[model samples]
Target: MATPDALAFRFFSLQVVRTESLGPSLVRVTFAGDDLAHFHSDGRDQSLSLFLPAEGRSKPAVPFEEGENWYQAWRELPDDVRAVMRSYTLRALRRDPDEIDIDFVLHGVEPGAAVAAGPASRWAADAKPGAEVVLIGPAVADNRAIRFRPAEGTDLVLMWGDETALPALLASLESLPAGLPVRAWVEVPHAGDVQDVVTAADAEVTWLVRDESSAEGAFPALDAIRAAGLPSARKPYVWLAGEAGRMKELRRHFVGERGVDRRQVTFVGYWRRGLTEEQLREQPQE
Candidate 1:
C-alpha cells in the first residue's frame, strides 16, 4: 500500500461486515468494500472523514467524484438528505479482503435523558451488517491526516487522550520505534474501559479511570501528569487529544509550566464539552 503522502482523498462506499464490543464502551466496527483495495493508511493515527446517512436513508447523498472539492458539493445538497460528517481514526486496515476497522467510543446517554447519543455513537451502537456509509478517505496510502509525526532527534514520546482518542493513541503506541521511551496518560470513564495496549516501545502507561459521577470539567489526566515527573529525554514530543477545554488547558500547562517548546507539542481537541462536533468546528481556533 502507498503512504498517505502519495495519495489523494477519494470517496468509497463501505458496508458494515461485523461489529465487536472491545470493552465496556468501545465498539469496533469493521467495514468492507472493493474500493478499500486502493486505500492506504500510514497507520499511526491515520484519520478519515465519514458521512453517515440520516434516518430512513440507506446511505448519505454526496458527490463522490468531486475529489477534493467534495466538501463544497456536499454542502450544496439539500439539508435533509445531506449526510452527517465526522472525523475518525483508522484503528486498523487490511487489503487482502479490503476491510478496515474503526473503534467508536459509545458514550452513553446523559442523565435523565431519553436519548443523548451523538450521530456517530448512535450509529455505531445500533449498526448491523450490511449497513452502508460513505467515506472520504485516501485511495492510496499516503494522505496527510496522519498526525503522529515526531521531529528528528526526539527520543521520548508523551501522549495523553480520553476515550475518544484511545484508538489513535494505541495505534501510535504500536507504531513507535522499538525501545524508544514513551509515557502515556489515558483517561476513561470507567475502569473496565481499560484494555491491553501492546507496543514495542519502552512504555509506561497510566490509566486514569474517572469516577462515574465526576463532572466533565474534571481533569484527572492533568492531575496524574502533574504528579508523575516528566520522562527523562533531551527531546520529547508531546501529543494530546481529548475534550477541547481540557486539551487547551493542558497545552498551556505543557508550554508555560513545563517549558516545552510550543512547536514540539501537538494538541488536538477531538471534542468539546457542551458542544457538538459541528459547533466545535465552527468555533475560532485559539
Candidate 2:
C-alpha cells in the first residue's frame, strides 16, 4: 500500500504489534511499521481511515492514485477484492519504536451477541501480533482532522461521547491544559466499559451504563444535560461525538437550550444507530 498521494496525508503500511482487552466491549490494538517513522499527529481526536484485508485476502488492495482520484479508483475495484474501510481515532502515539494505538468497539463478537459483527469488529476481535493493516493518516502534526479545538480564553470545557467515541474523548480530555474546569459524560453498554479518566484539568466525569439487554444502548446524555445545571462560565467550549441523531439532540441542548454559542460547540457523528460504516459513508456528512 503506497499512497504518497496527498501532501498532508499518506498511506502507512502497518501491522498489529499487540492487543489488549480494555473491557468486555472494547479492545485496544497497537500497530507498528517502518513507515510510521514519518507518522506525525498532535493526537487529540485525530481521525484516520483504516484499510483491512477482505475475507480471505492476505493484504488490503488500495489504489495509489494521486489526489482525490484514489477514492474513485478504489471504488472501481470488485467488492470482494477491495479492502474493508473503516474510520478510527488515534488513541495514542509513541516514539522510541514508533507505534500508534487504536481502540475498537467490539460490536457483535461475544457469544449470543445481538448484532452481527462487521469486518472491522471481527478483524479487531481476532487480531494477532502479525495481522496486517494499512492506515491513511496524517504526516503533519497539526492536520485538519484533529477537531477538538478550544478557543482562546475558554473558561470551561464540556464534553460528551459514547463507547464508539471513547478513544477520541479520552485523548481530547488528556490534551486539555491543567486546572481548566471540565465536565464530561460518557455512555457505554456495559459497566465494565467505564475506565478511570486521568487528566490534569479540574474535571468531573459521569458514566452512563446501559442495561445489558439493550442492544444499541439508550442515549440519555441529552436529557441528563437538559435536567442538570452546568457550571457558570464566561466562555465555555463544548465537544460532543457519538451517534449522529443523538449528537444532534445534544448539540441542540447545548446551543438552543443552554444558550451556548453555536460557533463554540464542536460535534462529530462517530456512527449512526442502525447504519453500517459503509452505508453511513455513502450518506452526506452532517
Candidate 3:
C-alpha cells in the first residue's frame, strides 16, 4: 500500500450537504465544497482536523489568507471568535460528488444537568444542510496520518477500538484483502450502536457492549482480550486505538504478557478518559 507524504496539509471550506443517523449514537454528515477538488484521502483510517464555528455563526472566521501558517493565526484570535478545532477520521470519500462523509458520535445532553455539551458533539447533533466548516487536510492522496501500514508477509490482523475509533477500524476492515485472517473487537456504549460492517476479508468482529454501571477505571474490553487467546499465525499485526489509559495497559499485555514482538504492533491513544483532546495533547508523550 502507498504511504502518505509528510507534512502535507491544506485548508478547505466545506458545507454540509446532508445528514443521516447511522446508529443510536452515530451521525453521518456529508460535506461538499468546490475546493474539495484538491482534496485526496489515503483512504484507510485517514484523519483530518476540523474547525467548527460557534453557535449562531454561519462560518468560521479563520484567517487563511495569512497562508499555510494558519495555526499561529488561529491562536492569535480572541478566545470568543476563534473556532473550536477537533480531529476526526474520514469515514468515506467520494470524488464523483466532490464530497466526504464523517461519522460523529452523538454524546447527548445529560438530563437535568447544567453541564455544557461537547462543542463538536453539540455542533454535529444540531448540524443541518448548508452548515459550513473548515478542514485542515491533505492536498495529495498519500499524505500521512493513514497509519495502518502492515508489513509484508503478515499472516493475521488483530484490531481493537472503542466507539471513537470505530470509523477507522471499519475502514481498515473494509479494505483488507479477501480471505485474510482478521479478528476485531469494537466496544460501544449500547448494543444498538452496533452496525453491520461489510468487508471482503474473512473477519470475525466481536461487539463489546460497555456496562455503564461499572465503576470508574474499569477496562472490560482489555479484560476480555486477555481472557481470549490469539489466533495462530506465523506473523500477526496488531492495531489498537481508543482511550489512552486502556490502550497503554493493552500494549503492555500484548508485548509483555503475550510475548508479541513490539515491532509488529501499531498502537495509538485516540483519547484519554478525563482530558479533552487539547488537554491530552498538552501533556508530555509517554
lDDT of each: 0.84, 0.90, 0.85
Which RMSD does model 1 reach against the true structure? 3.0
Instruction: Compare the candidates by TM-score and give the number of the best one.
Output: 2
Cα lDDT, model 1, residue 238 = 89
TM-scores vs. true structure, each candidate:
0.92, 0.95, 0.94
lDDT of 2 by residue, 1-286 (tens): 4444467898899999999999999999999999999999999999999999999897888886554677888888999989989999999999999999999999999888878899999999999898889889999999889999999999999999999999999999899889999999998988999998989999999898866565564556766777777789999999999889988888988898889999999999988988988889889965
Candidate 3 versus the native: TM-score?
Answer: 0.94
For model 3, name the residue pairs that clash.
4-142, 5-142
lDDT, candidate 3, 156-251, per-residue tens: 898899998999999989889989889888999778889898899889998999987899878888888888877788888889988888788888
Note each model's CA RMSD in angstroms: 3.0, 2.5, 3.0
The alpha-carbon lDDT assigned to residue 163 of candidate 3 equals 93
lDDT comparing candidate 3 with the true structure: 0.85
Q: In model 3, which runs have C-alpha deviations exceeding 4 angstroms?
A: 1-7, 110-115
Q: How accurate is candidate 1 locally (lDDT)?
A: 0.84
Best by lDDT: 2
With candidate 3 superimposed using the best TM-score fit, by how many Å does residue 168's alpha carbon deviate from the native? 0.4
Residue range with the least summed lDDT across 10 consecutive positions in model 1? 1-10
